[model samples]
Target: MSTDGRSAAGERAHDATGIAVEEGIRSLLLLMPRVVGRAKKMHIPEELQSFSLAPRHLSLLANLVFEGPMTVNDLAARLEVAPTTVSLMVGDLSRQGVLERRTDAADRRRTIVGIAAAHEKSVNDWLGGSARAWRAVLGPLTPEQRRLFVDTFHAYERELG
Candidate 1:
């Protein structure tokens, strides 16, 4: 071990910095649910009310709407949820006729879930409108500014993860 880089003072400073970063991250994570709650009050549709919907549901729906069908396990991995949880959520959505499950052509053992035909247009419209709103809000930013914003947000996400 190199002694020059292992001073007691350096170790204490590093510990203090780590503690402060963790506290800051904890505070930010705590605030996220409140922010999501406010946004839901502002924009979530009445049709989704019976499902005890959360942002996680919106996230799942959006992913399916935009990215096309995905297997329950793949979706769980993307959403950072358990496979059983995803299966339950997909089962509920399927029951509501919002999602449809189909056997994957290449993988007989896997079931791919996607928005039902009847719900496709509505899902696309909602996501499109949200995209429009985001564009309106952030469109004025220069390319450099937009890049910086994206980079910083991704860095924040990495830290939180």
Candidate 2:
């Protein structure tokens, strides 16, 4: 009776994983958008709002803060974007005094970009909101359950790659 024509149950219908899969997908379907929307709203510092940094720009900043600085090529790879696209974002943030780009001491041709120290307070404030939101959402879980949740998501991501 299902779309795949399996009497409304998949092959794992009788299995533990099947029940978990059904519940998990249902939970994710309900939570994914709300989580992303919370992150999108939480990731931007108030001070940077005057500079017209978009969600993409804020994501870049968040990535830098959490993952550390990187060269344009490395950042592009991580973001799954072309180097030029990353270059444009870096240039924009750099010009706005939100980021600093400098030559790598060992590699003259590589330019590393990071969040400027001058704006750390504002950036931290933005990150704080995101952290608070995640805590509010996930804090109810036991530590072991939280770890399992994190590990599950990491496994999911690896499977994607």
Candidate 3:
């Protein structure tokens, strides 16, 4: 028996696995602050500034860009955020002229959101820099380590869901 009360065998197994998991999590946690700080410091053009977009906003925009127009409820589901949160983000982006919102013709009561054409060039520019920064951040990691890191995070997300 261990001091914490688990059987000796169980405690040994759990502690061994727990230490590795905690060490991996700690390394990843340490990396995030530096990556986020670097990302925020990276330049985005002044014209795109009014778009009032942030890295967090990119997920919604990317969904729209890749999946075409979608209703706020659908977007909220995809983003794993509350409908009200999606609505607020939509409202802000709409006011900034970063996105266009319209009542879906198929369902008059449902509003669909899509990216605005005017910001296409700016979005592309911003995404290019963002991608480069991410690549640079991961450049030091071994291929297997990088893949494992991404896979672990995805697994964590799936577990949460």
TM-scores of all candidate predictions against the true structure: 0.59, 0.68, 0.60
User: Compared with the true structure, what per-residue lDDT tens digits does model 2 show for residues 1-161?
Assistant: 23455554553365644464455567787998897786666545567778887868867876786678889898888888999999999998899899999989999988999889988778867765766667797999999989998999989789779
Stretches of candidate 2 off by over 4 Å are 10-20, 128-161
Put down candidate 3 lDDT per residue, 1-161, tens digits, no spaces: 24455565544443543454345556767997897797778677688776667665888886776577899999999998999999999898989888898889998999989878888667666666666666797899999989987898789779769
Residue 99 lDDT in candidate 3: 87
Better of 2 and 3 by lDDT: 2
Runs with alpha carbons beyond 4 Å of true place in candidate 3: 1-30, 54-56, 128-151, 154-161
With a 3 Å backbone cut-off (N, CA, C), the pairs that clash in candidate 1 are: none
Task: Give candidate 2's error at residue 56 in angstroms.
Answer: 1.8
The parts of candidate 1 lying over 4 Å away from their true place are: 1-38, 45-51, 134-151, 154-161
Candidate 1 per-residue lDDT, tens place, 20-123, comes to 44455467679989876855555545565466656667878877866789999888988888999989889888998889999989988988899989877777
lDDT minimum window of 10 residues, candidate 3: 12-21
Of 1 and 3, the candidate ranking higher by TM-score = 3
* Per-structure clash totals for the candidates: 0, 0, 0
Q: Pick the candidate with the highest TM-score.
A: 2
